[model samples]
Target: MTVENALAGLAEQGWVAEAEADEAVSRRVGRPARRFRFRAEAGCMLGFDIGLHKVLAIVADLRGQVLGTRRTAVTPALPAEERLAAARRLGHCTLRSAGLTAQDVRGVGVGTTGVVAADGTVTRSDLLPDWTGTDLVTAFTEPFDAPVMAGNDARLAALAEHWRGAAAGTEDVLYIHVGRRISSGLLIGGKVHTGRHGAAGELGVLPSSRWDTAPGRLLAHWADPQTLFAAAGAGEAKALAALEDFADDLAQGVAAMTLTLDPELVAVGGGLSRAGRLITDPLSRRLAELCLFPVPVAASQLGDEAVALGGIRLALNAVERELFDVNG
Candidate 1:
């Protein structure tokens, strides 16, 4: 009865609606039960993933269904105002395609490559020179009169994985996003664990992590990671050896986090995750050797959409908190 009442209340709010009755499968003698369907258009959630090279925007319905999306590539040196304008352009495209206006949006979430403070300010950013200290929340607030939030791109990718990707159902997860720059995010006990400064799993900041020196440090002397990965996938010997060296460096940082968090699994994301076994096999083997115990490693299947999708998840979370009893 309580569940029915809740459903009724949700229906009143236009979140759900009665559907065609299922007459083919009747449980009570000959009478069939009425069906209810999620009205995804009840409210919209806007999500954005603003990275050093790309900006991704998405419009999702209340049921987390992605209605529309837009992705654009940009130079890393682009200024903050230009970047925000690019984001705004992408946001408008997504909303237009989704047949929604800003008024239909209930919440907005943004993910960027930096340490985000509590109020959605980028406290520090190593990639974009002008991104540091940008008031992301304020920037979003002026355009969208909705609940706005911001987070680190890696952390949002972790949230995306835990929500619907590789780490689903896991309580503790360590997500490493390996791109030109390597960063990390964690989920401790089914929740995103952002420390006091929101830089809890920012391993790239540590000089010992070797993320910065990895450009010419692949050991095999072969440049171009894409072609190298392709060659490795084709079973080239030199690329294989270089990959092993890179994996060893990567394992050092991953091992430290694994020993401390003892997470159930480590998910590798970002554009590099497409390498499949060429990367995870070496990473898994290296993790086995360096960690205190066996730590499972899974490559991302979410592609570049992980961070943007995670933004949608975060926006939905806030909407759910305000509209429904999440804890109950």
Candidate 2:
């Protein structure tokens, strides 16, 4: 079928096309002119960042304008389905606040804070014990009736930064979130590189660590990094020493990826990113000392919203693929 025909079909089916898809493909492949069914200004896209304490839902249109947003906290101890239901309710509330309904939404994109499989399952999560291997897509799909796309929260944050925040215009970039846990997200060629098994960028637990101890035992030292940072900020000498040591170890991990991926820029996010140069400067220097090449580092501009915006991008991509795949 012709591109225009596919575009019309998608629009009729309540899916909005991406404004840049055809242009991007044309520029990359030098193909004949094609278009997707996208509104210059139409309905909004919905995005959700499902976190341990709360679910954040943000809505935006094709022009990247945020229309409405809502945040709701729920018990992480609840079952995965219960948490997902709460999340869906939050999305509905946000849409209602904007004087719209689920029908008005183009698509739903989600970034879950844990290891997310391609099919939208939470493979594992220390933050949300009830979400392990839970199929989150199924939890919301029936209720919402819109197409859904799910991805790792950290990776989505990287995607958001690349598209609209600090990493804008960069094709090769690494976005690291250093809040509750340390995880890295990769953006190669303007897209998130989720690995073959959709397990890419799960960097919180070091691969070299033994896994037989216990479920959460691998990260038993988790609190140490935060405590060390707080002490260093307070000018404690011992804390300073510990912070420097931890920074060195983080640099080693980053350098290992640097040697392999050679990303152009490294953008750090999450609550700890506010530490700013305190962490980045030392880490950058250490990485440079250990690396064969120099790489620039920056802080995320969007802060926590990076992953929420990433969900918006994922939803846009999903609409294009499911409803406007001209190649299909």
Candidate 3:
């Protein structure tokens, strides 16, 4: 009975094909044993990183292999509506580049710079106030025919790190993101720990953490962050001292989380992670003094693509549900 339903669902659904019947196998089992092959191209998933400075879109197959990708520059001042339009256009372009269509997208997942609600709405966004109240589901719905969901960019980056990046095998991780924004996300028991309001790992919002404005202090010695980090890498006096101080500031909030949550590992991601040792080294040293027990600090292997890939991971999750759900 179960075999009949399995064949009917898989074959009729067009995601799998039945094997040829063998009389020898029938004689051995008293019935035909069927084998099926997974159709990797049967459907695709769309993932997007709608960030403060850019919008990134990635197209992937059921197997999580990235097929095509596109990104567009945006700004914090760019109106929310304009940014949404640019992102949607990128989605269309990315799908076309992959030789796929909107109908082929089984699910769409987004990582954006703000607090995402259960209904995929941005309830609050300190970086982009105009983005608040935007319905992310509706934002992508016009561009594709599929289920859509959105998550906080940093949180999703944590998911990506656990999926294939720095914290891949670690079950408990504290993912710290320091870019245009400073935030963190948690993976407890190998799962993305989105709190009750989808704001669990948000350490910047606290007044004492001072993470929201610490970048200003870090930039006091140099006008541009990239230039300052480069100088620090070369062992420049002012840049090094300033970065050390900044590292101390960054570690303060991280220590708070470490003492409380006691994550197994700490991952530093986002654009600043491109600085590599320039950022992670000082952060590691400061965390050593601040944390009760030593916690490993690692730079992101995925670099700028972490959040975009996390978006892909999320979309694949949704696709798997649709593809594997016999009842649905």
User: Best candidate, TM-score-wise?
Assistant: 3
Return the TM-score for candidate 1, rounded to 2 decimals.
Answer: 0.90
Ranking by TM-score: 3, 1, 2
Q: Any idea how many clashes model 2 has? A: 0
- Tens-digit lDDT string for candidate 1 (54-163): 99998988888889989999999889999999998898888989888888888899999989998899999878879999998888877878889899999999999999
lDDT (10s digit) by residue, model 2, range 29-104: 5655544544635677889998877789998875567888899877667777777888889989988988888877
Name the regions of candidate 2 deviating beyond 4 angstroms.
1-41, 207-243, 322-325
TM-score of each: 0.90, 0.79, 0.91
Predictions in order: lDDT: 0.87, 0.76, 0.86
Give the higher-TM-score candidate: 2 or 3. Answer: 3
Error of 3 at 61 (Å): 0.5
Better of 2 and 3 by lDDT: 3
- Model 2 TM-score is 0.79
Q: For model 1, what is the alpha-carbon lDDT of residue 92?
A: 80
Give every collision pair in model 3.
none
Better of 1 and 2 by lDDT: 1
Residue 303 lDDT in candidate 1: 87
CA shift at 327, candidate 1, in angstroms?
10
| Model 1 ranges with Cα > 4 A deviation | 1-9, 19-36, 219-223, 326-328
Please give, for residues 1-328, the per-residue lDDT of candidate 3 as tens digits.
Answer: 8877877787787777766665564356465466677777888889999988899999999888999989999988999999999999999999999999998988898999878987899999988999999999998877798889789988889999999999989999999998766899888998888888888878898878978878778876676788987898888998888877777888989999988889889999987677777778899898888878999899999887888889889888877776666672
